[model samples]
Target: MPAEIALLFWPLVTIALYALSRVLYRHYPSAWTSPLLVTPLALIGLAIALHAGYRDYMRGSHWLLMMLGPATVAFALPIWDQRALIRRHWAALLIGVIAGSALAIASSWALASALHLDASLRASLVPRSVTTPFAVVVASDIGGVPELTAVFVMITGILGASLGSWLARLLPLRSSLARGALFGMGAHGAGVARAREVGEEEGSVAGLVMILAGVFNVLVAPLLAMWLR
Candidate 1:
């Protein structure tokens, strides 16, 4: 195959696989059958079977990656639509988000240190609670491996989405806002998706919390990284 044709094929195949996975998960929704979990595994298996290289796959997948920016920005619309609720609870939200954000950073650093991880690994771990693009940029600024940071962010999101509902039930959380905030702060976009599954109010608040948490990480992570260095 010509280089251009090969590149094009990979992206198309990836998209088709993702669509199939979504359809499968939608029809058979189980914890283990999540599209988020299934799509990646399916892609990896296909890539191995096709003997596709990561660089080539990424070349084809870049378009999908680029779309993430706009998709993230679209969350702003929901936040704006829910502005009244946000204003009514701004103080509590801000305080709660900040506290959660602080703990995320602190616990990540402490755990990495306990494991004797290097500075690079610690930097990558620090922004794992936020979205991928935000985490990558922040990780890069703080002298981390952007690739590793992206992986960490994805893992955190998947785990958050998978466990959030169970944890919510197990905990003493009495309010939708509280549960949503916890999900958003801990898991980012995946958590927001899970929250949406629970209720519109939970989803909306989770989206707001995810955005706020991203902003907090962008502003604070670099300073913390510098100090730790």
Candidate 2:
């Protein structure tokens, strides 16, 4: 295939794969058995087997990535739609988001330091629990590699999806709302989705918390990075 045609072809292939994954996910409800997990790995493995470099694949795929910012912004619409609930619990929700974001970064940094991860890796890891687009920008601003930040975000998502529910249960949380907020703030989108499956109230709280956390992370992570440095 011509280079230009390949550029167009890869993105279409990725979209088809994503659609197929969603279909499969409907059949396999377990986090460990998610099609999101299976499909991406398959596509990546195929890319490797085909000898397609990351840069070449990214040339097409980056268009989807670039839409992340706008998609994130669109999440605000849901928050707006739920403004009444937000107003009613604004104080507690604010406190929960702040506390969750702080714990997510601090705990990761502490663990990474104890594990003897280098400073750059530590910086990347600090924002791992936040959403990927925001985390990548924060990592870049902090002198960490955006690519590394993205990898960490994926790892965090997978771990959160697999263990977050169990961990939420283990915590001394009284309110399902708070539990969901913590999950979303600390685990990003995947956690929010999982919270939705758990319950409607949990899902609503999680969605609000995820949006708040993403906005807060984008605003605060660079400052935290400076302090870490």
Q: How high is the CA lDDT of each candidate model?
A: 0.84, 0.82
Q: What does the lDDT come to for candidate 1?
A: 0.84
lDDT of 2 by residue, 102-158 (tens): 888889889989999998988888778778878888888777889998888887887
Residue pairs of candidate 1 with colliding backbone atoms: none
* Candidate 1, poorest ten consecutive residues by summed lDDT: 220-229
TM-score for predicted model 2 compared with the true structure: 0.93
Alpha carbon RMSD to native, model 1: 1.9
Summarize candidate 1's per-residue lDDT along 1-70 as a digit string, tens digits: 4679878888888788889988998899876777767877888898788787778788867888788688
Pairs that clash in candidate 2: none
> Global CA lDDT of candidate 2, please?
0.82
